[model samples]
Target: MSLTWRISLKSDEAEGPEDYFSSSLGIIFPDDITNQHGDAEHSLIYTSPHLSKSLLIDLADPVKEDDRKLFSHYLWNASLLLAEFVESDSLGVPLDNPRAAQESLSFDVKGLDTLELGAGTALPSIMGGLLGARRVVVTDYPAEPVLKTLRTNVVRNLQPAISPAGSSTTPADSVLVEGHSWGELEDSFSTTHRHSFDRIIVADCLWMPWQHANLHRSIAFFLREAADARCWVVAGFHTGREKMRSFYDADALREVGLEIEHVWERDCNGVERPWDTEREDDVTERKRWLVVAALKWIQIP
Candidate 1:
């Protein structure tokens, strides 16, 4: 009759003085629906505890009123998946469900300097901080309110790591949260980090087919900042598989000067499986495809 959820936090085994840092929000679904698509944009909802008592977020666009509620539901489920990773210890974390595919990925959060684009709730960046990345910068579209919420959530969730006393023992790694759009990336990152990111992580950022060019441009600028920079871009889409063919084609990536070195299947347990071209019809129709693409900046030695 009632929905119940729980949140957990786990420790990491990386280079930081602290062993790990993580948290989870649990949800117990009521026995009402049986056949449901496990999509984050269709299953999760989050409420703010402020006296005003407003919904914390609605990830979908407000213009599409009918779809607004559906997106909220999906965000609620995604929050749960993100909480799980925050609480886990492993570097390559598997997502609990397909809805979580967007937030679930391991990055060198502790020692390596990194940047995360379209951070949504900033879960991936938080995980990076816990993993011991020397510095982790999270950015989203400048016009979106999601960026602010992400900053708030990061501070709230990572309070222990930011404390003055904790800083002495664990050494607080920089977790910079900011508003950044593809249009301003070159200027923004250049001024702040000054060409100093070792790794770049992007998740679920492609979908607006129109923005593909801008996205590619932004990625190129960042990768060019460092000759050895490595980028991992994960995109999750449920609408239609054929729509992505143009975007995922090898030539498109090559045009941006990025060479796809590996294409791996990511299991729920977070292990990378060898590439398999087989397609599942049922899954193709219902769930979005989760793609893990690794790219290295092709700089001639």
Candidate 2:
């Protein structure tokens, strides 16, 4: 027997202005099924009016099958979520060129040496590579299966070449995948790429209040030396207002010398709101909003 699931984009009837909204389609198997091998056996198909693509990811259980299963599940969920965001076209306004919310935040990516922290599935980093960035490094935690999956996605999605300005000149070559953790930022920076990236991009990385200090410290340590460095942290707040308050009060960002310059909201289409009055207590059904914060280093000139 096969199961089919649909993630609806329309939260309510009042439609907003965008042709398509981004969403992810997730597939899960019954827990009793122990023969599960990897993500490659499962097929994920993504379709939009403008873009349609299907990818098959393999799951290799080198040591523990259970670990592989858990990792695969997370990747599948993450990919679907990212797909929804990209398809919805509500990620953010294009700062430089017409690109996805993650890509657009990089301000054209042209000639910029960039790094994407906690880049699950590496969409923004891939976009940076597509946009002719001088060098694009996609980093996540040092988890084995996660890193493997990240590398696989990078190779699967890499374009033949990047045409800067859509010109016919030599195509730009950028490295795609790497590993770094907020906890290991100091060592990672000292060993590899050492004080390099001009722009650091982070999306949906501030969900957990506990990660604030380490994340801010990593950003500060790694990005402290760029001549004109900027860290763009984009967070989509679906958790709740209390978590947001906690995150703010942590002052992790202040300890690292970064300040939020502006806060704004973007109206997105295809978002769905459940009408389940009975499940009001369910945190998942609570109303959610998208929040963007533009951060820059405190200049003392």
Candidate 3:
């Protein structure tokens, strides 16, 4: 049977302004193997116009398999956005680019201790390592399948210099894959890595409202207690604005001693705008917008 159904990424008519989905950072999806059968995984190459190199990722067929395991196996749009943000060299607004407002923040991963919480395919962490971060630790739920795939992707993408835990012979080696379950401060990872990272990357990990407090705990734990340190988060509104909003609530963040330095909603076309709380329920429309934010640990007297 031939596939003829149309897959539309947006609605017939957007209630507000025109859709900005097309203004995405150059994330080119080049191939998908049709000859493969069963549950075999396929490779995806993610490239950006700003990046000198492309990322090779192996996502499980259909991606739903990872969904079953807490969405820890598939490549998400938020991940791509986070990666784009990390890869961007936009120091300040440029008059030459029309989408200049899209990149309102600068997040250079170079020479920094980076950590990614719930890194499924670990795209952002891999990008950080490739872009010359001082150290990049890719972590996820301590599950065998999840950790295995994460390690494979890290090695495949950041090969030659990639070092496994306890095997590093030099400082030149960057990427490290590990198992980390959020809020498990009693665990070895939590104890040893506390106040360890300069930057923490979280993409599309806010869908689970119940895990918000625990997620904050992890962020407060690993994030360095410095003024310049940041936890860069990019979460899609596809899961609904309320669910995403709960995670970034100011009071809630204050409870964990983490404060939002900057937060905004960005359209697919690279336009940065304020969040709209009164918007109607439209998952597709919501998907067209991403909440990008930077949070820092609040110093207490």
Candidate 4:
């Protein structure tokens, strides 16, 4: 359960869970959960080793705060691109070549640590565990009702396979869910969680340009300063680029002392990123699109 691809549906039909699950591309929803209103929150947690069925966790109707519109309850296209990049042999960033560096990482994880910021369904964080991260902390805003769904999905996704009576389950300590409000570091996080992660994932969280400064403060505190540590990011303007211009710019990241190493832009459709062929003009067919990047802390002289 390392990758999460959410497909939200609005259904006028009051079909049972079975019908809903069957209609999905892959992954099935849990039995007995009823749809809320006309909206059904369905997500497919893609398994590792291949693009096969893993687990399905149905999320409850999300209640987004007025100021947090971009942090909307629905899943954005960014998560899909993020998952593909993490699993692709290319690792998407040709300049930095993240895949090459990741291959050097031991599958056993050992001392590796990962964290996912604004993890709506927390698909990337879960992928980190499957990819051999020693510890993965999935965090989002402190919304109790919403956090309940986040916590449930993590447990449901990470649950070990049906084992023999004598056997144990996937190490429980591998992942933890937390409610973290950005900008208020000292009040929300402790030194134990600070500068501890070897890899960090922030996907589809940059909707509020006003909060970019606060987000940087949180990233600076939590991001490890080690030479090899990197924070992988995928972002886009689903609501429109004008809504969140700062996240697409370099000034905010530079102010936080983070050095941008690689970046790639893709249209919303699922085309092979970093196109294998000559540059095509049709790539810009979509006015709204997604952007992915690999960033690291800028070491001081």
Each model's lDDT comes to 0.47, 0.48, 0.66, 0.57
| Tens-digit lDDT track of model 4 for 132-209 | 456778888877655776787778765545211222333568688887887777754545698888777888777677
Residue 184 of candidate 2: its Cα lDDT?
A: 66
Off by over 4 Å in 3: 1-40, 49-53, 60-67, 90-104, 160-173
User: Highest TM-score, which number?
Assistant: 3
- In the range 154-249, model 3's lDDT, one tens digit per residue, is 877774343222222113355678888788888876788889899999988898888899999999989988878889898877778777667888
- lDDT for model 3 comes to 0.66
Query: What global local distance difference test value does model 2 have?
Result: 0.48
Which stretch of 10 consecutive residues in model 4 shows the poorest summed lDDT?
30-39
lDDT of 2 by residue, 1-301 (tens): 1111222222323243331222211223222211111233333332222222333333323346744423333222223333333323322332221323333333445567778777755655655554456777777766676678678766765454332234221133457566676756446444666557777777666656677777777776666474357766544434544445444432666766766654443312223232221222223322223344455566521
Q: Which is the winner by TM-score between candidate 1 and candidate 4?
A: 4
* TM-score-better candidate, 1 vs 3: 3
Error of 4 at 56 (Å): 1.0
Cα error, residue 272 of model 4, in Å, equals 7.1
Ten residues in sequence with the least summed lDDT for candidate 3: 1-10
